[model samples]
Target: MRKILLLPFIFLPVILFAQGQHTLMDTLRAQLEIVFKADQQYRLPLEGMAKKYGWNSHQVDSLYEGMSIRDSIDLGIVTHILDTYGWIGTDSIGPSGSTTLWVVIQHADPDVQKKYLPMMRTAVAQGRAHANELAYLEDRVALEEGRKQTYGTQFQLNKKTNKYIIAPIEDEPNVDRRRAAIGLEPLEDYARDAGIAYKLPASPPAKPAQGPDKNP
Candidate 1:
């Protein structure tokens, strides 16, 4: 979607001697924060503009080009961290740090998202990651794979209508319950922020799932 360049970038020398892994994690956390801020700088401003003037195709394209560059760079760092240390969870890097990892992966291509989905699931089970972020990533991946999303977190801008709408969701009427389980606001509520007046299906609500979706 949308993806900062903190000059004096992430190339700082990492001292891992007697300081141990904690120091290494702190450095990584700082790097993650830099990447997270960069990820937002372009997209947030563009989102504000879209809300004010509606989506301008040229502006959206320009913003995405910038975001894609940052996203690729961020993804490289995230992939290296994951490869070297496995998933750095909240316990090791704190909530914001863990979220930065998820954010990069979520913005990655579908193949990259699929590659790391299982590890993220385990991170969630261990309480090292936020379920809400997992829900968003899960919905994104599912939509890319031609499947119905679970949390209704993925939306598409209908070029014709010039509006945002939730992507297809499984058991649509019960999506709110599924979202609630993972700490996401209701779909309708989330949509409103994007200027979408979302409405649930007329069908009766289905029984809630035992937990978040079991599929990967």
Candidate 2:
């Protein structure tokens, strides 16, 4: 993608140089900032609510319904930008702006995540996107596809324990090696942040029921 591409929003005038000096990049960046905040606005509150009231509470469910609406709107915006811009990255937009694109997609429905996975892989290959972010996406896509995660980045909240547990991972023992290649901390270290006391078993877990490539 070009460093600066004209973005003509359907709701607004053709983006161009103006008296206010609002260029296409400026509008795109502004949209990204709005998306970033909206993406978190419901989520941050939900996290606090989950901690205080528990996941199954009516309060948590109500907040989640609202968050789901915001997520759908954000997904539409992000997909539009991606379709128009093709994964433009930190060079064209700042880091936070670029991240907003990935963040929205990461939180999107599984089909959306799967559709954009290859594009993000290309972005990472071109150094437009972060490898670590790609790693997270890869793990999510794998899990969504009923395959074991590669980098062990995905976790599930165990309702019984009210604690998080790392999702099923392929090649459990060497997950850290894959993680290190992409600059993520070891799986155990990452699990700790979720309050999980996890360790790689001495023996590798049974090879994931044969499936598509899980290697990152």
Candidate 3:
């Protein structure tokens, strides 16, 4: 009977730990999805973002493949145009050293091509914009990760006090730090604002005094 009763105690903690970890992972992934949406809006490539996150190319490709139907269509249009018409060749350069090939090749019936050219140009411009936006997103992701690590360390230290049940830290700094830095607050208050319980570390212990120096 005692063994069966004790078994519940052991399993209970294991279950709770697993549940907490799952919640934290889900929250992190939700934040990542927001970042991914911003990238999609700007037509950012996922290759570099994947590499920055240490994900394999196959994983990155899978993510892009799984995008929503609307996002997939936009990406498809941009990629196809770049593949078909984006080339620049030395042979097409004019005597003045400017390449007229793109303009000439794109010329169809004056009314039709003129209407489409601006849309094509916008696609090209968005593609270039994507490169810059992806770079910014990569930096933002890295910064968020570093913030989580810092907050985790602080949380662990604060755990010594029973007053606080430290919650999983977020990746973003303004959110994580501002919440964690709130001085001497209860766990529920932090959880309400920051999506997690948090507490600052208790003050450090006083250093022991050095013994009087022995005469050399």
Candidate 4:
């Protein structure tokens, strides 16, 4: 599945935007942004060239972008930063940087995500990270297995239409309430941005508590 940088303000903004004094998460977010953007910017070009020619096709032009070993190396650095410096609060890194962590972790190995999610989730509770960040992570972990996602962060690319389709999520009946609690806008907004059609329930069910995932 092709994953676009679906978390709003999550990709290019990290490069153009500035944060408060370089706290641990702020610095880590910047590094992670660089690597993740590289992956996004180049992965497609690399794949196109690979398909047209072949793997390790040295004849390929430099303009074709592809993921490199450097990505893994940098992910290790960010992981170390998270593990060592501990969770930085939303007060410190703000929403953009916190979302940057979500993007970074999204690209990391599943094992790495599993290891750091609890810490990241705690940061969300402490107001270090956005609750939306934890939600995005939960959705990603579930989407990896084709299970129902909790926060509706996952999207799938339609090859025939060349469009992005919002993936399945759990508790569709109460998705918006869950979304609002975590600082996310309505599901329709997200789906709209990706050019997907979304129809809300005629009326939402009872609201869930305004909390992050129960056990992300």
Candidate 5:
């Protein structure tokens, strides 16, 4: 008589691998590391161009135009893979993959983000993922689809008008509560990090009353 034992294999296509087991998360971390580096590679050039050609110059616009297509494609492919694999969290993939996923989602175009939002929301609801991803995407989706953002990440300055265009937040009064629920810092802190001057709108001057004139 002989006895045989079988050993488990290290799977490559797993979605919920724990930290440091050479699983799918390694691939995710590797791919996103390259992506993050590529993103940073443009920063110095952009800053130099801004200094030389002016911040709002046509050259900057051209740079953005060229990058937009590549950025969209990169995000599209990555997000598609993510959606297929289901949402992975810090508990499953460890800090590297978790941080990389967050960065990728943040850099992704709003449309791409909206496309993957359902999976992310599911993860949150299932207690496998953090709520911040959902909160961030909710705001991005609202801005792109012309509704109120819930987390307020879509602020921009209109260069021509020299005014801020803040994406509306639903229930502005308790926005901090929503943010806290999702593990985000105070709105003021986030605004400062994003370089926004959150201000209360100034009151308009009262209109002068018109006087009645009588013809004699």
Candidate 6:
């Protein structure tokens, strides 16, 4: 009988610890939900936001598929944001919308909050910047990829001359081939005049031999 009574006492601390952890996690989730919802209000989808952060679209979608906005905003996510972006000002905007939560935390925890508050701000800023840069880089890559697909390797011959040549499109290279298979002069000149930089391929396609070969 005594052992049974003592059993509850022994497990009390464990119970309390579990409860405290759960409460803290719940609180964090609630706060995060607010932030996530606010972000959505601005027309930013979580998938797009994740992509901006350099996350694969599928991975991000899977993570948030069944998660509520509240659950997604947990303490872990907040900490991640803080670690990435620097803490500069609490009132500043964040990727997930306004930094009102930071301000609230500062007001509520004052002394204790000061220690990690800067980290949170820092993470938010860094995360935002990183996402933006990734988005821009992806756009450029997609454009280049599209251009390559649209323009095949062969350059059509439009005109030809010893000193001057013109092609239907620009050919890639540096060779003595006078077949005007989209000569590089226009591209090179345009790049120079427009202050753009580009390099010609090392070898040009060989020009078709003039007339049929005698060696049937």
lDDT minimum window of 10 residues, candidate 5:
1-10
In model 2, where is the ten-residue run with the lowest total lDDT? Answer: 11-20
Candidate 5 TM-score, true structure as reference: 0.68
Ranking by lDDT: 2, 1, 4, 5, 6, 3
Cα lDDT tens digits for candidate 6, 17-117: 99986675455446655755543442345546675764566656655553444333443455564555444232234333324334223222234254554
Q: Which candidate is the best by lDDT?
A: 2
Q: Which lDDT tens digits does candidate 5 get at residues 1-216? A: 122232233343352355445556677667767766655555547877888999799998777775676566667656765866767766756555555565567677666677677877787788766677667767877777888888766686688978766667777767778788878887778777766767533346679998887767
**On residues 1-216, what C-alpha lDDT tens digit does candidate 2 reach at each position?**
342343335324423335234466678889999999999988888888998999899999999998899998999998999999799878777888888989999998888999999999999899998999888899999988889998899998888997789999997888888999989998888888877899886764567677898799
RMSD of 4: 16.2
* Reference-based lDDT, each prediction: 0.86, 0.86, 0.40, 0.71, 0.69, 0.43
Which ten-residue region of model 4 has the weakest summed lDDT? 59-68
Please write out the lDDT profile of model 1 over residues 23-141, one tens digit for every residue. Answer: 88889989999999999978889876676666766777778789889988999999999988888889879899999999889888889999999999999999999999999889888
Worst 10 residues of 1 by lDDT: 1-10
The regions of model 3 sitting more than 4 angstroms off are 44-216
Clashes of 6: 14
| TM-scores of the models, in the order given | 0.79, 0.79, 0.21, 0.62, 0.68, 0.26
> Weakest 10 consecutive residues, lDDT, candidate 3?
92-101
Q: If both were scored by lDDT, which would come out higher, candidate 1 or candidate 3?
A: 1
**Residue 84, candidate 5: alpha-carbon lDDT:** 69
Residue 11 in model 2: lDDT: 22
Score candidate 6 by TM-score against the native: 0.26
Candidate 3 colliding pairs = none
Give residue 106's error in model 5 in angstroms: 4.2
